[model samples]
Target: MATEKRNYKRVMLKLSGESLANDKGFGIDPEVVYRLAGEIKEACETGIEVAVVVGGGNIWRGLKGSQGGMDRASADYMGMLATVINSVALQDALEKLGVSTRVQTAIEMRQIAEPYIRRKAIRHLEKGRVVIFGAGTGNPYFTTDTTAALRSAEIEADVMLMAKKQTDGVYDADPKFHPEAKMFTHLTYNDVLQKQLAVMDNTAITLCMNNSIPIVVFNIDVPGNIVKACKGETLGTLIEGE
Candidate 1:
């Protein structure tokens, strides 16, 4: 029970849906998922326990439901399903690359994957298996970011690695739009919440703060960054911890 004896024994990684897609937001890109799998495989090779929370922005988003006026809960449920699709694609990609992975859905599709059971998920990680958590928190109106925080707390993950499509670190403004947005190499959770820095939803940020979890926000486009960041490399902004 030596706490796994890793530089980071447990890590919760969050990947945006767009990160898994190509230029068009239609389907999963095999190459991107493969590369991501490689990065995660390396981390596991180093004895780092991994769990992933992937988004579904590429496939769908609850917020963008047509003006026909879908209920907020219904739209959010649709978003949850979208995450399941991404999870299935990711699982296939990882297996293709010879990496052992599990997809646990909050919504419970036993034929496809196991339900999200806290003890079971932790056991998977303890066995050095990568666990992919899908379907958002089994709740509506919550983003995958909130799922990351909730799961990280439950599994006692050492860090939450948030992998973005672009922009390496937290910035004062969107670098894509504002050429001079100041990038923060480091920050506190308060900075993200109080300042409304937009790293994640207010609920997610508050959850991390309450749980005292450290978070690293970085760009996922960098092939090996997930592993590097897990080993405590200075790749992006570290928030909310000593």
Candidate 2:
């Protein structure tokens, strides 16, 4: 693939924690990690800078923990730790595939990974290293989706690639439940907010809107979707400002 034809120079990839879980469910699935790494390696090899934000829902959901009576902040902190674990797993997988990668956490954890440094991360990407962001804002009550938006704006990415586990694109309703639900090929940020499409949280959507960053929501179940998205193939719902 020629680099000049690619639409995006740099992109922020948001991966759900559930995507990393095996068929049995819960915890990191090495197979999934390796497969994802392969796809990402293909994208990076195209000369596009890539940054990733992974969710921790497979390991822990702070909201669920809080609903079960755990302190909200404490539960959220635990969730952050879960993201770190996923980030490390992804970093290891990418490295093993011969892709240079870096795991940078918002909260300091010098033993395993470097602390998140905005300029340092940008430099890494410029040098052709993939930077994986973990520890979601280093704060409670924010989803990795928001982290993706925040980091995307901070790093000046061309688009945010939202990798869904089973969902193919943004739909009028839950496609899993409603077989006839309409899948949107293109949408405006306002349309998502007006319809409450649920492609991402309001904060994430609003952040992208304010930053004028586009988002590509696509199925990650397919092996090469990530590369397809990086290649600017029309394979998913594209969300942007009107």
Candidate 3:
């Protein structure tokens, strides 16, 4: 069969830290990371520039800590550190597959990864190296989702690929609990906002909306889905301007 033409030359992949975890959802699973890396390597082979922003929820959740009475900033900093760890692990997995990769952290950690530099990151992507962004924008009170949005705009990505661990796409309600829920294949930014869908936080959604970057929200566990998403084969909910 002939391959479909790719719609995007560059993309920002938004991943939750839980995507790197095992079924227990508490720690990094080497097998899972390796599988994910292999898929990413496939996407790179297609010549698409892929950048990643991974959350740290598997290791720590800053908001949860703050809710438990910890200083919010300190807790958020700890969460950033967790993302660094996940980024390093993913970098290792990708490199093992013979894919050149770079880990850039918003918060500087000279010994572990390079500091985030916009121009340098774009250069790396241009050279076919996958760049993993860690540390969640180097600030407290910002999510990795927001980091993905911010970086996608700065790097001029064609689309934001949200590889969700939960549902395959945006739906009217939680499909897990509501079997009759409807999945939307496409949506407008205003529809997402007005319906209060949880596709992304409002700030992240607004950022993409303002910049006119399309977002694809899809399930990550299905094998080959990542490559399909990169090729724009239409597997999930697509959010863009009307």
Ranking by lDDT: 3, 2, 1
Residue 91 lDDT in model 3?
A: 97
Show the lowest summed lDDT stretch of 10 residues, model 1. Answer: 1-10
- CA shift at 80, candidate 3, in angstroms? 0.6
Question: CA lDDT of each candidate?
Answer: 0.86, 0.92, 0.93
Candidate 3 lDDT tens digits, 1-242 = 21244489999999899999968798999999999999999999988899999999999999999999999999999999999999999999999999999999999999999999999999999999999999999999998999999999999999999999878999999998999999998899999999999998999999999999988999998999998999889788888898
Question: Worst lDDT window (10 residues) for model 3?
Answer: 1-10
Return the number of clashes found in candidate 2. Answer: 0
Q: Please give the lDDT score at residue 173 for candidate 3.
A: 97
lDDT of 3: 0.93
Any idea what lDDT model 1 has? 0.86
